[model samples]
Target: MSAHLLTHGIIHSTTDPYAQALLVRDGVIAWLGADDSADRVADPGDERRDLDGAVVVPVFVEPLARPADARDALSRGTAVVTVLAGPEDTGAAPADEDVQTVVYRHADRVDAEAAGVWLPVGTDTDPATLTGLLTASTQAGEQAYLVPDGGADAGPAAQDVALTALRSVAEELGTAALGRVRHRLVVTHSVTAEDRAFLAAAGVSATVVPDADGVLHAPVASLLADAVSVCLGAGPAGDPWAAVRSALSHPDPDERISARSAFAAATRTPLRALPDAPAAGLSVAPRLSVSAPAVFGVWDADAVAVQSPDGRVAAWSTDTRAGTPLLPALDAETALPRWRATWVDGRIAAEDVARDARDGATPA
Candidate 1:
């Protein structure tokens, strides 16, 4: 966090020259000016380093084979952590290297294992042999990474192999394992349009690289650690049961019933029928006028059944009816609302209903 002055050479930021003399304070560049101008303002205790005509540019150095260097890079605020070796160099044992060591330590915290290993398929290699290798690897509890080889082209071939390996591993492991695998692809030099299309078809995850240094040696283990961090860092987005509760409050009687059924299906809980109330204020009340097909009577109370526009039967209490009470105004509401005649033998058959002398009782 202290201030420092760097002078004497061209500074490159990205692929272009940034400045001649750069002044950095609190890990940030305060000013970039001429070397003489920079020296005039330099503080008494400010650390100064001369570049001696060498290019002073930011470069990433990965420490896969060296733990001390990685730690030092981390202390210096390096942006990327890379591993430059293959699995063999790091040892297949999982504990000899930093990446594998971290993964093994974190594996016990989560119920599932996370990691994927991709092997590029070549033109000369038999397709079956590559598949078999992927299957064997997945069966041994390791996630496979795959890339496809597009014919005789070496670049495409390597990518195809990587894709094939990843897909095979995912399929062999099933859904539970699929959820845990760290999906990635491997490419020979650069990812091409054909390589991308192959990846989309295969449904595998990948990272393209030009050579071995681009390949993260213990990618599976490294990915697993990252996955754990991400999982632990994320918070719940919203309440899970909000939609079910809203559906139950729907205004339409049919929609309300449908919502209850849907909720039951989703939660695997048995639903109970709503108790019948006075039919007077029910939303499904029938109407009568020139629209009435015919007048049907219910003798227990002042009510009449009318045929709805859709040819379904409905009843309206005479007290709530306009023009005239269907039968005569009675002390209580009419017969209880019941399920449609067609659904009598369905799930609502267990409910009871009252009958009038003129019209038969219907069970819901």
Candidate 2:
């Protein structure tokens, strides 16, 4: 990733705005200092990008609109902000806009206790054909259906009805539409706290910002951030565990192991550890034996044993549960538990020894 510096702009960092310049490196904000102090802290090889005195507010750049810009923003550690506009209001294509608009309408109905429905229209089909298609689809279990130009024109009353119908359909779908359609639900105003909690519990990300009147701002940031996080495999705010899980599932085994290890360390939950003698006192060194591939195992007072598939026995302090594996500890002199002991052909490797005292040869 290329490093750059954005200078002479009103930059928003979290909740505060600063007049100083921000040094960006590898897509993160490396330093934020006064413009005059740039020479003292700025990297010599960084590319300087002047903001032309514009207020550089962070806006969530959509992948479809301009992916490179989004990448740049993420690299710069910019907090993505989104505007909550109804899908129909956004003027996106018909097919692409339905899901978003449906979600928005459902949220609106829930907030205002109104009714709504999805109005599907074919761009190339005439009014009669559109109505026929809608009728057929509705008969085939599609609810809250409407044909554009056949039901009603775009108006407040018509919109209300449409929204109400859409909400009904959403309810019928039982939240499955959310996953299937990839729609985002954003609350644009200060809703009841109970509603907010409900949304959060439902795994819907939301942001509450205050308006000029001290009212909470619409949750545009949440919606945009959700989209960005989904694409980047980063979890939404207030949910770091999901992101960690995603990192653990990375394709690269090394990355997956590293992520799992980090997670285990942070949570104080020992995962599979290498088999080795319990360290002196409270500290224990896990070692992988030469006879077995390094594997994950749990340590307790009784024993340290290898997990299934890769079976290597190491010393254990006590009995513990077998969960995930942590990072592998490497040392030249110490022999660690072989994780791949079980995978050694038809019989266990000659050097591999079962720590009967610890686990009693019980396969984890």
Total clashing pairs for each candidate: 24, 41
lDDT of each: 0.31, 0.29
- Candidate 2 regions off by >4 Å? 49-52, 60-153, 170-364
lDDT of 2 by residue, 68-103 (tens): 222222222122212122333433222311111111
RMSD of each: 35.2, 25.0
Q: Which numbered prediction scores highest in lDDT against the true structure?
A: 1
> What TM-score quantifies how close candidate 1 is to the native fold?
0.32
- Give the per-residue lDDT of model 1 (tens digit) for 290-318: 11111111112122233231223344434
